[model samples]
Target: MRYHIGDLNPEELLDLYRAMLKPRMIEEKMLVLLRQGKISKWFSGIGQEAISVGVTQALREEEYILPMHRNLGVFTTRNVPLNRLFSQWQGKKSGFTQGRDRSFHFGTQEHRIVGMISHLGPQLGVADGIALADLLRRKRRVTAVFTGEGATSEGDFHEALNVASVWNLPVLFCIENNGYGLSTPTKEQYNCKDLVDRAKGYGMESRIIDGNNILEVYTKVNELCNAMRKRPRPILLEFKTFRMRGHEEASGTKYVPEKLMKKWAKKDPIANYEEFLLEKGILTEAIIDGYKNEISTEINSNLKLAFDEPAIDSNETKELNEVYQKFDYEYFEKSEDVENIRLVDAVSQGLEQSMERYNELIIMGQDIADYGGVFKITEGFTAKFGRSRVRNTPICESAIVSAAMGLSINGMKAVVEMQFADFVSSGFNPIVNYLAKVHYRWGQNADVVIRMPCGAGVGAGPFHSQTNEAWFTKTPGLKVVYPAFPDDAKGLLTTAINEPNPVLVFEHKGLYRSVYGDVPKNYYTIPFGEANLLRSGESLSIVTYGAAVHWALEILDKHPEIDADVLDLRTLQPLDVESVFRTVKKTGKLIIVQEDTLFGGIASDISAMVMENCFEFLDAPVQRVASLETPVPFAKNLEAKYLPKQRFEAALLELYAY
Candidate 1:
């Protein structure tokens, strides 16, 4: 059956032709630059221009969009600066990211275009998140995410689709089915021939369109977008187009069989649409020539602008570094007179006060709303704050964390509880990729707090006994806090909630019931990077935090003659390097202690910092007392052996001999 150009006016047809010509011209010039070694790599949407331009034009200006690397057509059609696009390809300061991010990782808040992430299929979840936000805000805006058929194989794709369909979110999932995922064809990847069939399983509206026919692509997308805006729901559109160019600049048609290449070449989407426009008398040969010349001139002008741009300076790089360092040490000054309160109560009071002051603050997790969390940290919050502010989430850890990230992105202050710190692995991806990197990627902060009960003193055994703070300490763009006493817990938690980045607050299970100290009822926030000196002596310095801080204090009390200086690192990521250097410089000896295994523990980082900052002042090598490198055993005696003890008396006896 022949697909007509549709009953559109001459002006509309000319617009479609113009959209097709711009991307094609850009792709053609990019290929020349790539071949001449001017650009490192190029991934062009040569034959698939019709599909991108048609679908994007059908979207509303306020609707959200997420495009993949081969989406130059969509960006060009949306009027993104061609100069910035070329600058990004050339890795120049004039690029969209100032040469920090890869090409095609472009974004513009003004245009409602969400940034493109390098990780495939993950954007699908991001699209759903944006749609969810729009729904909550009553914005009536749809989210359109474009990806390839290969992205469907990722776990995030299924997860996002299932959630979008279940919630009836306004999202348009466009799959550019160009017959092959790199070298692997669709038949090799799955048994089903139609990608739209997969969408039906999720109870979403699904359709397949002839991508080569610009009119058909635009007509279907327009209907879908209109229906979505009225009563929003998820829909999947699979555009069956052909890839005329190779995957990237380096790839060639050597692997592609001659017969198959010729077959796909016949159905080239751009060429077909141009011929259709010419046949319909909507475009003349002179107009086409003029369009090509205009596009060529624009490309050349952008190229010259990119080359003339100034180089990045070292100060600029340093300033970029400061942007990710969100933790401010100045706000964490210690009180001369410490308060006396229980650790659990201090945590609860901090959260309660924050919620009272900040109306946007919302808390959620297992048993948090009604049960006040497993440790009673959030007890009575639901009764006081109501259900909207204090929520109880299902047992899906991934979904809970991801939803918190989404909510935070939409201007809500979200505090998520992980029943136990060990259970954080379930939501690791969202924490690392979405929550932590969102601000760095888009220059938009997501203020979210993750509270978890951690450490290994309660005999909770293997699954519940692990300390995973080190895992996040190694990651950039995250704040890790571990407070020892009640006052510090209240103060640090207040700071964590107020900070504009993702913060992980690890509350020791033992300290929740054991430790007590004075905490003020007024609004007070503790700084994250400053260390607290529990006891000030000069012979040796014992540095620790969380449950170990209590043990160190006890040891210091028992052995008065040792003259040990006890330092508690309240925040692990932005460590108190100043306090550590001062103590090491005066005492000339250091000992680091932690409950986690010695291998890749937080103590290692402390030891490295000491060596780098105060190596000359050291009288002896720094020592570490940590749990053995084995899983916590169920047997009480074995567990005792597996955990790290203060051993202050023994250390004092040895130090006296020296």
Candidate 2:
């Protein structure tokens, strides 16, 4: 089924020709900007413009788009100001990322275009999640995800495609087969002749299109998008194209053979489409010239607007003051009348209550629905609300996190769980780069809660056992909560679920089944960044959280004469410096404790914060008590020795003596 330019109206043909010319001109200008020392670098989508421009044009304004770095054509066609692109290259305030993000890293919610991630293949999962959100809301919108052929090798690509196919999501996986991924040719990377064949492995319908033919690309994409909007099924479209320039501005074509480069360049998409338009009489030479002139004028006008646009002042305070900007005091107030309940039951009750309260809340994760999650936190969720609200995902951590981010962006509250916190590295990119930073980058908020089982007191060793709260403690836009008791866990988890940002709720392995104080049977939330002072004393401040919080309390009890002020950091990212300072002022000594390794752990951060913020009040050098720097040993004897039990107790005793 060969679609030709002759089948389209003169206006449509001219528009395609104009679209081809504009992106090329923009790419050429970007190179000039790079050479002139105005911009640091640039990535050219020169030969791949036809497919990007055409596919984006076929989709409606409300539909979502997630493009990789070499997608200037899609952004330009979607009405992203070219000047902002250039300014981003120039590291100016008027740039899309406000001088904070690198070139081609711009995204706008107003344009229905999600931010571009430089990392390959991560966006596939993000797009899948977006499609799922559209499916849940019954909205007639498709999510288009674009990436190079090389991205196909990433596990996230397979994960996203499989999930999207299984769920029948309205997502278009557009693979721009530019022949080469940087210096590596597709033949060298994969054995298949057609990239579309990989889609069959995931049980998805796919097509191979001549990406150089703008009319063919646009028509086929339009048909697929329309079909998806009707039934919400995933489709894979492999667009065959070429890269006219090197991988990036800094890359030299020394590795790429000149003969192959010339061969691909001879089949230039822009030139071929221009000839097709002229040969078919769909657009006259004069009409083509006029269209080019008109598009050029528009591009120039947008460039001027981008230049004249006010640069975002980096010196100004960030707008996210709820919890990320400063410590939230209201949620931290101590509850004198705390109820008694099992920690795991408290979590399950909180989730069940919240879902009942908010109709928009959706829960998803591996073994979450019928399996009730690994710890039975989501037990009976599917029975109560049905599968649509409580979904069980494939064992793809990247897809789970990305989908949560996408759903949150489109105005749905998502509570995504990880089977274990140790496996979070699989979805770390979306959690850190996309979900955590999207609100600050795109000037919008995403209300999503990611719950994971963390900490190592149980016998789960190595891969299954890890305290990873410190891994994300310094991430600027995310809220990291680690609750020690049943009441604190329930309250903080509820608060994180309701907060208008991506939040990581780390449930300690030791605390999940531990017997703890009762939780109130009512709707309540504990705010982030406020510490709970479990015990008050004048000798030293024992700062801790999660499982270690319980350990610290126990140690303080064993030695009542120690007189230590026990501070539980409910949230890690938004550290309560004021409270720590006040406690240190009263005690004049500090002891930081955690279940993780002492080196480069949460204890280090607490120690540094005390030294920097409360140095004047310190009477002795701040001490840190943490687990030994080794994988949690499998043997019970070694495990006990590897743990931070003695270190925490010794640190408290030493601080009291000081």
Candidate 3:
């Protein structure tokens, strides 16, 4: 509990010195390796070492810390092996990311570290989610997240702070004010006098500390941790510091004024701490040289081992086995206990069953609490799961998704709901770049699901009625499922919750109340990448998903003369290509339909696959019936023409006649 340098013993003071000194020594040597082309890139934390070291030392082992690229001292101080760190720098198989990414861009659960996304601001929200997990588990741990002064300008900064303050979660937001974003100064970044001053907008507690004084940082952060542990709350700490080196080794710091650099050189964190310890008789020249010699030998010997480690590459099956967490894709079972229900009720029952099964499962979205969301899918969730499990988030899509990632990092499953599928554009950065990429980058599975209410038949116009399932199907490391019937909706959504990786459940808004089917009362799952044979005929193959499936069914029942084999693709991402080809080969013709526009729809990809692989089996040319390349219109006649339903009959007849 004694945090002040004056109250510390000689050994404890030396520990602090060693923690700060090792990163400086390693990075100083990394400069030599960069010149020799041994490592491709390095982000220097030369003078800003105290922020990382002091923060790491002040927190408990279980408390997670999300770090930016420049926080190398956090890794070193935590005692992650020198060889593994160096292996990462060398793109070797033994690295933290298995050579998938370089630098401190990956996190290891072994160290309770969640590496920041390249965007630099989403980690703050992740910290909030980790803190939320601790609170739910009744643990006395506070989450720490770091960012540069430049990142405060991002909208995520506002969302993370506001959400933490609103919920009163235990989080310490450390802003390393290193004077530059890449080349831009703090003056050009924001109008605030200091970065901590921005915390007032969220009505949160804040402090300004001299980051160069390691003791001051350690002492103040330690006291704050003790306080937050007792009474959970969020605080913003602005660590006034400077980047003594360039952003990376390749970029020179010529843009920074020489006079300013000279002024900060005198305030070097390691030197400042060393001088105090020396005056107190806690350090000697021998101790300094002794640390340097010890660290140098460790770096050199480990560099050799790292050099010998094999450099991993894509498709190296033996080395890349853990890229993404494997799931039991065959979790589905048929049950005789059935009831007629709408698609929305089936979805609600599926969520309820998943919640009853897994206590760690959390559902979060705007107006999803007492209001029960706009679509009423989560009408009674808050009452059953409590506010902690069924949380109502601010209208912050990016932070909401990032917070789910944080929850996943803490070994919890999360389901984030976007009221309208069109709103996914706001959270695209984290969904595509972070959630979709983290597993492949670091092998950290994001066990999160995003419920997307999509489609265009409701006449909600372009913004609310956009079928954007195609956007996510192109992205890897994510499962995309769209169901037309209630049976498949409950089955696929339950499967999504059970999945270890991120899954997007595109629940068609039109089918929620309109479509009805016999769904099992008991819990069950439907395997992904499996197609349902809805109708069997030899005339032609009608392939579709979502609302278009119903339109195809309507056309077939009205005219029994047109015999067609209908294949309902439950999942678009894993896309049952085998079934598509089978149906194509059986009928010797095909027609792919979707609610989305025709230009760049998922139909084009399926058409290409059919032409490439199943061309010889086809008796006639393949055709695609889709909406025109335009936004959904509000007018009834225009919307009717914009959707694929009106053209389904003609396309099917043409394909059947061929």
* Best by the lDDT measure: 3
Q: Could you tell which candidate, 1 or 2, scores higher by TM-score?
A: 2
**lDDT per residue (tens digit) for residues 1-658 in model 3:** 1136657677877898999999999998999988888788989889988889989999998789999888998998778899999998888888887777878888989989888877888888889888998888989999999998988889998899999999899999999999998889888998878888878889899999988888888878999999999999999999999998888877889999999999999999888788877887888999899999999999999999998876676666843455458876756586899999999999999999999999999999999998899999999888888988999999999999999999999999999999999999989888888888888888889999999999887889989999898888888778899999999999999999999989999999999999989999999999889999899998899999999999999989998998889999999978999999999989898999988998778899999999999989989888998998898998888999898887888888877777
* Candidate 1 C-alpha lDDT tens digits along 307-348: 787664446575456446354543544446655778998899
TM, every model: 0.90, 0.93, 0.98
Ranking by TM-score: 3, 2, 1
What digit string (tens of lDDT, one per residue) describes model 2 on residues 297-414? 7767866776676655654444444224233434434446656788998899889988997898999888899889999999988889989999999999887788877787677889
Alpha carbon lDDT of each predicted model: 0.80, 0.81, 0.89
Q: Candidate 3: which pairs clash?
A: none
Among all windows of 10 consecutive residues in model 3, the one with the lowest summed lDDT is 1-10
Candidate 2 TM-score to native: 0.93
RMSD of each predicted structure: 3.3, 2.8, 1.8
Which portions of model 1 miss their true places by more than 4 Å?
1-8, 315-342, 359-413, 433-442, 646-657
Ranked by lDDT, top first: 3, 2, 1
